[model samples]
Target: MARKAYSRRARVTGTLMLLVALGAAGCTGDPAAEDSPDAKPAGGEATTARAEPGKYQTLPQPCRAVETGTLDAMLPGLAQLDQEQRQKAYEGTSSVTYDSDRRTGCRWKVDSADAGHLLRIDFERVVSYSASVSDDARAQAVYGDRMKEAELPLPSDPREEQPERRADDSAKADRDEARATAPADDEAGQGASPETSEKPGKGKEKEAGKSEEPADETVDPSAPAEGLEPRLLRELADDAFIDDQLTTSSSGSGQRTVTVVFRTSNVIVTVEYEVQPKQVAEVPDSASMQEKARELAGLLAERLSDV
Candidate 1:
């Protein structure tokens, strides 16, 4: 009985030792465990989590909420003419304001020539403003010259408050007369009277009027063909960097033309080349034009930054 009791005590001691060994193994932590194939390191710190490579850093000034009241104040007066007249002469359809750490400015979209033109105007105060017109020369012509002149009178009450009713009426009358005198296909074959034939100058005048009518009919003076793509322009303007391409092709001879504009906040670079008569032009030949465009874009971008 004594030998059996001692054997049971030894068995209990061995069991306790085994439990301690198991507990120690469970407590051990391996620092290299995360290095295993199945384990993933925290985001952004891992070698596989690098950002995609690209030119230009993120913009310093992001677009913010637009100021409609400021825009209204800045908008050129259209009160001199009727609504239809106003729509034809000016292109301030939509406006927005953005805030940057450095300054605040406004952007607007105007449709011209069935395309979009982006206009950005930066305001220093209620009385002072600066403007930038994008790549389109036609847009620049109207906005820079005509619209700029018109807006000079704004932020003030004009002494001549009367609407130009006579001007509007005369324009409408001229349009109607032009439409009436236009010749149809059937009318082209008809012979005129002896009196009409004698008065050749009068008939010529009528024919000239007919020819002019279509120009008036299709012309929306408010919107012109040289307008900018306002939204795209705004995006490009707001971005710290932009790389975009414009391609145009001629159907007559299967000729193609391409223009690329690459820009940064301080610089704009353009590359334009033509593929015509089934031949691509040499880069050296287009270098001057491209450089000129780049210079223009850079200057415009810098000016726009102020607004």
Candidate 2:
């Protein structure tokens, strides 16, 4: 009887212990598993992010990229040439480049009965050597350097006066200001005569003269026309600018060079159009040259995207 009683007691104790263990587990809740999202990934190191590469890896053929019709239009003298001569003129001589993929250029010079024309086009494909830097970033830096070298005018301020004359004007203005502010040489009011003393009307007249001084009347011979001043271009490409330079020879014949530069993706295109009149009395037109150069630049930018 005693053995039977002891066995029943042991069974009761085992059941009570099991129930307590289950209750504790329910209150505490289960620990997060290793595969949980909150846990670290298999590798301790995080993945490194990389920049996207440039859109263009190679450049188009510089000499053949432009259409023959474009050539004829830019070089109007082509119309006067014979069929064989025109065809030969259309095929421009390619500039020598060690690596054509990196940089390439083409230029043509033609003389007509009235004037001379020179056209040049250059294409550059920029590549980034650093893994952290992108090609587009490098190209932007390069384009900025070119812009600085070109000495483009500020956006808000227009260069109405010539560059070489600015210093002279500034000096003159400074001198006038100094004279106006300078005190009269230690005049003794006690002994001052009426003739030497500055009269009220005389001082007023002097001030009026300073205020009425005429502005610079001499126009810069090399300055572009009012609306044709060098400025930033818009809607032509990602970013572009046009500059017109007019230089006259001793004989008074002017040579005008219109340059347009733009960048698309990682490629940069430049167009240089020059016109030099043969006659001393003749001068190149600024508006027409700028238009032609800008048009060529826009066309080249579009073709580069397609390529």
TM-score of each: 0.25, 0.68
Candidate 1 regions exceeding 4 Å error are 1-4, 27-44, 52-84, 92-262, 265-300, 303-307
Give candidate 2 misplaced runs (Cα > 4 Å): 1-46, 157-215
Winning candidate number (TM-score): 2
Candidate 1: tens digits of C-alpha lDDT, residues 165-188: 657877999999976896532344
Q: Relative to the unseen true structure, what is the C-alpha lDDT of residue 165 in candidate 1, on a scale of 0 to 100?
A: 64
Count of backbone clashes, every candidate in sequence = 11, 0
